[model samples]
Target: MACLGFNPAKIRNQNLHYSKPSSKIVPSSKPIKIKPSPSQFSFKLHCLKSNSVSEAPLSPTEPQISEQEEEVDDPASELSFLDPEIDPESITEWELDFCSRPILDIRGKKVWELVVCDSTLSLQYTKFFPNNVINSITLNNAIASISDDLGVPLPEKIRYFRSQMQTIITKASKELGIKPIPSKRERYETVYQRHPGFQKGAKPFLTLDNPFPMDLPDNLFGEKWAFVQLPFSAVQEEVATLKRTFTFGASFDVELLGIEIDDKTLIPGLAVATSRAKPLAAWMNGLEVCSIEADTARGCLYLSVGISTRYIYATYKKTPTTTGEAEAWEAAKKACGGLHFLAIQEDLDSDDCVGFWLLLDLPPPPV
Candidate 1:
């Protein structure tokens, strides 16, 4: 019998033939190039595929697998798009071109007429005037009528009135070339009197009392004076310039002793003492009595070292003395009586030296 079984080589060749033929056959239909609409594409690709593909059988026409995915990505497609409500160009036009309406020019008009014509603007205009005149608006029937029509609060309207009066006062003062005097709180406090006295039978050296008597002396000779020296840094050149020129103009003669640094000293005093003196001088306009006679050789460059000192000295010199030098000397002795005395020494340590001594006479009673 002829062998019914096929040859092993032929069978193997036949299996290979079947596989090659299956892969090689060209598909009859061209790929249906149906582009998906955005909504339809999104629904199937995202929602439906995610939900039904896991369990339900896919349609025969649908692609079973994704084609070769792109390796390179487009960066522009990743960015989100935004829409703004306002047009930038329109905004520019509005700012540059728009003028809503015209406002009235009511300069030099009566307050009532101004209030009546434009109640809304009346309060603002009144603020430019003084309170006294503004207060008078209540008596004006036209102003009252406007206030009633506008339903403005009575208190607010009164405030406008007060503001008007204040404006008037300010204007008058400006016109008259008179500076308005500041209220008491704004004014610097004056040194009315300074008296030093020991408690009855107390040791004078242990306790130094400031003997500023309220009673005006008949003569202001040999009165105690204080000198405050100001030391400024080189960085404060502007302040220093102001201090030198405008500070001591004809309005008031200020004695400028000289400038010093933080390290420099007026006399044999602590660096802190000289520093303290600067602020004191600034506050007092450098007023003080001459402690020692002006000596060009001993670092005492000026007669006295402060603007305040200069003013006090000048004032004292201009005022008349009731008692002569002899009586003044006696009074000085009386003032210094019982206090321990130390000789004035320039080279002495700051601790060893006594406090500064000034011969300032009390001013006579005001007539």
Candidate 2:
């Protein structure tokens, strides 16, 4: 299989509307906008009947510190007051961001900072730096100091989403024997709220705008596809009891979204049947799929993935029937808090799926 480069010009259709985050259930007449930022690149392979999905809370001995640990003017001073005995469930993986904040320092320049936290956010460490000194070596030293001061073991992996900072982050992680993964699934840091610059409410310093949709490799295209839907209860039950060898992509408890998912509510989705099922599924597995969008006017379906990458996953000739299906998909997705799915199979008759991705257009974090 050949690795294809992302070419934005290939599918830059101006007719497509990029959605902004919204909470209202979009009517069929409105263009639904479900804007969620980057997602984690996590592909799982386990039997549906054999494996159970869940999130485990941090261990009991670990203190549940404030979501964002206290921040100070000086990075070095952080080590002085931090409880050396602070433990957070033996966290082995961390989310990292060494970026400028929405605030500025007394020097009339934006403050740069290195922020680190585990997935559950039970452990958080932050340090502010002057712009000139932001480098891999500085990052490496800060991480080392945090490890020594907290008596916590160094993480095995550090995940960061800012692609521009990949080189520096990778260099720092490699020097410390940690694997670095670029993923969009990092949570926004709330520590900035305490800063004076944000007291009046300011936009994030760094945000990935939605890029133009690109084309999938021609060879991996599916033969047949359709807009589909199923009751939420059926989908949830199948996920729990279905007999399957493997599945991958995003999965989370509906309760975590803060939106109630009524059992009988209909959930919209896309289903593809093709001889290239395995390969198509394989390619998608590598991506952090965000959500699927339908353009009723153009009669096309777009796949939103990674931090802000979009793809022309499929297109249909403009017809009333096709346009109606697209509208229904958009309307249903909006009704369900931007929840949707993608399923790949050899053909409609096949009892098993090559892949299934539970995609969501996540709402923006609270202010």
Best by lDDT: 2
Q: Which TM-score value belongs to model 1?
A: 0.14
Q: Over the stretch 147-249, how does candidate 2's per-residue lDDT look in tens digits?
A: 7866678899888767668899999999999998776563233234434443245555566556788886675467776555666776675465323545644
lDDT of model 1, residue 279: 37
lDDT of 1 by residue, 202-256 (tens): 2211121222213222221121222222111211332344445543111111111
Highest-TM-score candidate: 2
Candidate 2: residue 135 lDDT (0-100): 91
RMSD of each: 46.6, 12.2
> Using Cα atoms with residue i matched to residue i, what is each candidate's TM-score against the true structure?
0.14, 0.65
* Candidate 2 residue 193 C-alpha distance from true site, Å: 5.0
Off by over 4 Å in 2: 1-93, 120-127, 145-156, 186-194, 199-204, 237-246, 257-259, 349-351, 363-367
Clashes of each: 37, 3
Give the Cα lDDT of each candidate: 0.20, 0.59
What lDDT does candidate 1 reach at residue 200?
Answer: 25
